[model samples]
Target: MEKVKRKIIKIDEDLCTGCGKCVSPCAEGAIEIIDGKAKVRREQLCDGAGFCLGVCPTGALTLEERETVPFDEHAVHEHKKTLADKPEYNITMKCHLCGTTEHDRPLLPIKAKGESDWVCVKCIPRLIHG
Candidate 1:
């Protein structure tokens, strides 16, 4: 089958600090920082919505157009869940209450509709009770 053309985001090695700040938001698991630079696993997995672009503070990542290997979305979803099961770096913003790591915690359950970015459920009360 012919590969699909998509915009893949690559982190400039010279610029990335290996902060790992971009991993959680990527639902496709396309971006992984290796040697302190973000690398796209497969362009086909990337939707090119640029969500990672906004989260990156270092400006190390950028989108480039090219042909990419095709990937099944359903398969990617299954893969993401598997990866999530592992105890990896937590990306969710810190919880306000107990000062716990939010990691992959869902945003809605942790905070008001739009009060703050996603946090942990444990901190929700403090955020709300306060």
Candidate 2:
């Protein structure tokens, strides 16, 4: 693939805690935890939309424009298909109470104030009682 100047995800290893928090929000399956740190798994898979930015606990992920592989939509589609079978990548919803994501644990379906939301097991008691 030809290198093109485009905005893509950049990971600062020093700031990355290897929490894997940035993995779930990436719709393209671009980020992955490898060797205990979050790394851009594939340049072509990253659409440079920065969807994974707000989910990071640490300031590890950033979008930088430089010469790199162009984002491939077809490749991302194929990648997502493979990830659909994986349990970890399946759930992207976060806990409405604590903001915990499926990357941390499976969220349960609940109705709050006639609105549906996802909550983690740890917060179930709190949501029910209060």
Candidate 3:
């Protein structure tokens, strides 16, 4: 019988800058940055590859052995889809005018609120004058 290894990923929320440096490295998409902190959303996606832990510059991520339910690849993919629909707390964009923080790209001329401008909401004022 093949021995199934238990895996657990621990992230130091205090050390995490919410940079999301670990997200892409994880093939399973087990880790996500929520509210500016790295969190292991599901153990099923983690193959214990130590990819995320190694990529963390602040040493915020560490993998430890622990008792966990068996890893499920299917469930992991499903979980990743659910995460995609949820708002990303780490999403950040630069304002073209004031150079302040903007969360995401503009919706490309959505008609909401009688908005006809294509610029991001933060840059709308500058666009009107320019």
Candidate 4:
């Protein structure tokens, strides 16, 4: 396959708080939180659809034009299958604040706040300070 200049998702590690808000929005399973940083596992899995952009509170993700490998739907399917086969992938919980279900653990347990609800990492500040 010939390389092409296309839009791709870029994550600035310095800006990413590993809130994990971008992961669930990426239907291709491209973005993942590794070592408390959001990373794109595979460039081919990103479709440049910008679905994960709006949810990033820290502005860590951006679409950039670059000459690189093109998006591959087949690869995305395979990646998703690999992820689905993992035991950890089966563990999912819903965020009480946003009602978004996620495979990862909730960043904050709000039991100390007199509420037995879990808040997603991205919404932690709002739930704590607001």
lDDT score, candidate 3, position 76: 78
Worst 10 residues of 2 by lDDT: 109-118
lDDT of 1 by residue, 19-127 (tens): 7767876767767777666777655667776667756666777787777666568767766776765444345555554556545453322224423244566556666
- Model 2 lDDT per residue over 1-130, tens place: 6999999989899988897766776778888888999988788999899877766666677899999988899999988889877765766698988999878987665644534456889999997798
Give the poorly placed runs of model 4, Cα more than 4 Å off.
Answer: 85-130
lDDT scores in order: 0.63, 0.80, 0.63, 0.76
TM-score of 4: 0.65
C-alpha lDDT (0 to 100) for residue 51 of candidate 1 = 65
Q: Over the stretch 4-121, how does candidate 3's per-residue lDDT look in tens digits?
A: 5686787878888887767755667777777888877766677787756655667787788887667888887677676655444233434434555534644222222422222467
Tell me the lDDT of candidate 2: 0.80
User: What TM-score against the true fold does each predicted structure earn?
Assistant: 0.61, 0.71, 0.55, 0.65
TM-score of 3: 0.55
- Candidate 1 vs candidate 3, TM-score winner: 1
As for lDDT, the candidate ahead, 1 or 2, is 2
